[model samples]
Target: MAKITYIEHSGKRHEVEVANGLTVMEGARDNGIPGIEADCGGACACSTCHVYIDPSWVEKLPAKDSMEEDMLDFAWNPDPARSRLTCQIKVTPALDGLVVQLPEKQI
Candidate 1:
């Protein structure tokens, strides 16, 4: 399991272990962590699951696909450098200490 830390806009933090092969959004949803709405489940069809990856981990993650980039345009205050749809990020051992920051609201 990879340990992921979710930081809410209000500064609230939730740390949980997510098994490999699941998306980051799944970890948040299963743990009942607020912030990620995941309206489209893990389908990557919406921006409700958008989040800002910690700068230190940004280079460590995979590049965003064109579809993910397009969907982020619909997110609330997306940061091009750090924003990513949780559903697009697969959990892996390399992401054990991954940290993501949630936007103030989902649009």
Candidate 2:
């Protein structure tokens, strides 16, 4: 399992243990971490699952596909350098200590 930390906009933090092969969005949702709506249910079709990867872990993740990039445009206050759809990030042992920060809003 990979341990992921999720920081909310107000600085609240939630640490969750996620099984490999699941997506980051699943980690957040399964753990009931607030702020990730996951309206599309990890389908990568909506931006409600948007999150900002901690800079240190950004390079550890795979590059975003055009679909994710396009969906991110709908995220609230999207950061070109840090914005990512959690549904697009597959959990792995290599991401054991990953951290992601949630935005102020998701709609």
Candidate 3:
């Protein structure tokens, strides 16, 4: 399992242990981390699951696919260098201690 940290817009933090191979969206939702709406249920069809990956961990994640990039366009206050769709991020042992910050809003 990977230990992931989800920081809400209000600075609240939720730390969770996500099984390897599970998406970050699932990790947040399963653990009830606020700010990750996951409206499309990990289908990569919505931007509600958006999160800003900590700069230190950004390069460790897989590059965003075209679909994810497109969806991010609709995210609130998108940050090209940091924004990511949690549904597109698969947890792995290498990603232990991942930190993601939620936007002020999802819609």
Question: What CA RMSD would you report for each candidate?
Answer: 0.5, 0.6, 0.5
TM-score of each: 0.98, 0.98, 0.98
lDDT of 2 by residue, 3-32 (tens): 999999999999889999999999999999
Shift in Å, residue 81, candidate 3: 0.6
Clashing pairs in 1: none
Better of 2 and 3 by lDDT: 3
lDDT per residue as tens, model 3, 1-107: 99999999999888899999899999998998888999999999999999999999999899999999999999999999999999999999998999999999998
In Å, residue 6's CA in model 2 sits off its true spot by 0.3
Candidate 1 lDDT at 90 equals: 95
Per-residue accuracy of model 1 over 8-38 as CA lDDT, tens digit each? 9999999999999999999999999998999
How far does residue 8 in candidate 1 sit from its true spot (Å)? 0.8
Instruction: Extract clashing residue pairs from model 2.
Output: none
TM-score, candidate number 1: 0.98
- Give the total clashing residue pairs for model 1: 0
